[model samples]
Target: MFEPHGPKRLSDIVTGDETWFLFFIIPPKRLNRMWVDGQGDRHVVLRPGFQSRKTMFTVFFNYSGPLVVDILPQDTTMTATYYVQSVLSQVKSVINEQRQKVSTSRTLYLHDIAGPHKARATTQSLWELGIQVLPHPAYSPRLGTM
Candidate 1:
């Protein structure tokens, strides 16, 4: 018996995130949904009393699990130059080592429309690697499934 690749794994659907340790808590929209029959009480998210420091890291993973985690140097800005010069290399290594081998298969890169991710140099870097970019909408959290 053989298993045909269906939706595929991270090769078909993948997510990468560059997060800073900002302590802001955003309540999900579901919190606003209230049953008017008095069956539920209003939910609230309290703001933190003290501001918290932040740390930044870039990570890539898919339905199966995590693939890469690259912590950025403090105060480092992610520009097209920096991304192509640094981030792309790490991602390439992950894809090279962890990606499933299938002939004539397509790899769709589904990163969000972040400034660095969309820069021309970054796009060119991906192009050189023969990875196709997935069209992404800005501010669309639904597309970010990680």
Candidate 2:
């Protein structure tokens, strides 16, 4: 659908995704080198078995650069209500501010077919913000190739 419009349409397109980030990263064994005086004095490095502390962040970006990077609150599960009130609200403000030079009347959003992204609340919020979502296929043949 977007093949013919070219650069102007591409520039108005914004895509986003959420990812979990580890708060602590273990150093690689190569970087753990120690200058020990004796050959038998090398200490053992233990690796933790438990899951590391992590934070979830939702990031939005366009052709220009990143527009929003919102950290999900600790212990909070992402839901349609939260997505609309928190993330999309910030997106609306940032889009208005960053895309002021270009017209935002037809800003297009592209995201995966996640539950929250396809929720009714999210759709309503996007419409209220004057942003349109590009249709995403639930299944793609090329998915396995990647």
Candidate 3:
């Protein structure tokens, strides 16, 4: 389902046209933590804890009714190049089919992040599909997969 940032127009959510959206959820485990000992007479130490482990997922929020693809990896290993390539192929096929159905153009908004797979083939494939990749700024959490 779609929701506008400022206003909720019925037409926005139920556009009745083919709109392809790629939803990516990347849960990055905060790599590591470091600490320094302060000069104190037997001081107690404290450190912040990370609550969740790193995981990535993708969802196709097809705006042409309830079309969803819950495709995800079964393994819990680190992200690999093959996995990204597979996802790219799947997404490209979906977009092409969706565009054909409603007789209209398509748009894509990719979340900005750096990784071996994301930086490689995924970017090039989207561009070949005439998809617009969103620009990402350095050290910016505000514009992220929330």
Candidate 4:
């Protein structure tokens, strides 16, 4: 469908996703070096057994570059309501402001089949914003078996 438009079609496509950001990262042993008087002064670095503190961030980008980056609010999970009201809304405004030349109605959105991305609220919101969602194929393990 986009063969005629080529690069222009690619430029109109926007993709978004969420990822966790660790509050603390353990440095590699090579980078954890320190000056010591002797071998006795060396200490063992114990890796944490428990999960570290982390925050989720939603990022939206197009062919040009990033359009929006939003941190999830503290103590809240990413739900359909939040996806529509927070993430998508911010992306909409940023696209309008930074990419004024691109028509919002022709903008194609791409994202994985996450629960929030497939939710009714998110679909309605995208429709209201005049952004078209590109259909993502669902992975089927059964098909691979054959």
Candidate 5:
């Protein structure tokens, strides 16, 4: 696991300004819970190829099951800048839409993510987006949980 220290303050989450970049991963089990059924009740179903999902640009597309993807990077890539750009763009869009639904400001606070590439690229990109990046320790689970 590419774990990094967690955030310490509300600003660390960046959501209050209506901008928060909290990264999490959901395996197939949790993915199964969000699926809508024909009857409109959510149910968990066992899918054969759910465990063999593919990771691309932080997206875990499991065809046999739900389509939820883990936004955390599982490994460092050669072209980290591009990867970060793609992930952040998608994340920012979703966040903006959600904030708009609640009529909130789009100013975000991006707590530093744990992965090496995430640390480097996300920080730079978020700064450009006017989100404050909280200071974090090197290897503390407390930061991640917050």
Candidate 6:
């Protein structure tokens, strides 16, 4: 697809990626250990509570570094509508802020081929924002081997 543009400059393209973070942290095992003279006196340690609790963040940037990060609300599932309305719109702000470094009119939007990213509404929203979505291989990282 980039063939039309020929050899491209890093400054001309921007990529967006999303990741999740868990607020809860597990203290180092050594820190949890207590040096007691007797084995029965040793202290016991427990794992973190609510390990599944986490927040998802979408990062948008180019070679210059991160431009924007959107954090999803706790327990919210990312859907197509939510992605376009909340995350996709933020790309505009990133472009506006980095207009001098990036293209003033348009930039390439690279994201995984997830259902939300490929939705018609999302594609349309990107088009309206002067962004062109770069094709990406579809992979479900959540899957497990048979």
TM-score winner:
4
User: Candidate 4 — which residues are off by over 4 angstroms?
Assistant: 5-8, 25-51, 140-146
Model 1 agreement with the true structure over 1-146: per-residue lDDT tens digits = 11476554444555687988665555566656655557766665454243565778888886668877877777888788987778778777766666557421356778988899988898888888877777886675777796
Model 5, 2-69: lDDT tens per residue? 13543332322432111224444445555565656688866545564533333333431212332223
TM-score of each: 0.62, 0.73, 0.42, 0.73, 0.37, 0.68
Q: What is the number of backbone collisions in each predicted candidate, taken in the order shown?
A: 0, 0, 0, 0, 6, 0
Which regions of candidate 6 are displaced past 4 Å? Answer: 1-8, 25-52, 100-105, 137-146
Which of the two, 1 or 5, has more TM-score? 1
Error of 3 at 32 (Å): 38
lDDT score of residue 2 within candidate 4: 74
Of the two candidates 1 and 3, the one with more favorable TM-score, higher being better, is: 1
Tell me the deviation in Å of residue 105 in model 6: 4.4
| Candidate 2 TM-score to native | 0.73
Query: Higher-TM-score candidate among 5 and 6?
Result: 6
lDDT of each: 0.71, 0.83, 0.45, 0.85, 0.45, 0.74
Q: Give the local distance difference test score of model 4.
A: 0.85
Best by lDDT: 4
lDDT (tens digit, per residue) of candidate 4 on 1-146: 57985644777889989999888656567655767786566765575343468899899998888899999988999999999988888888888887788668878899999999999999999999888899986788887788
Q: Enumerate residue pairs that collide in model 4.
A: none
Candidate 3 per-residue lDDT over residues 96-124, each given as its tens digit: 57556632124544444646335656666
Model 6: lDDT of residue 109: 73
Worst 10 residues of 4 by lDDT: 43-52
Give the Å shift of residue 125 in candidate 1: 0.5
Candidate 2 residue-wise lDDT, 8-127, digit = tens: 467788899999998766666776576788557877657534347889999999888898999999999989999899988888888888868765567988999889999999988788
Model 5: colliding residue pairs = 6-143, 6-144, 7-143, 14-19, 14-109, 19-108
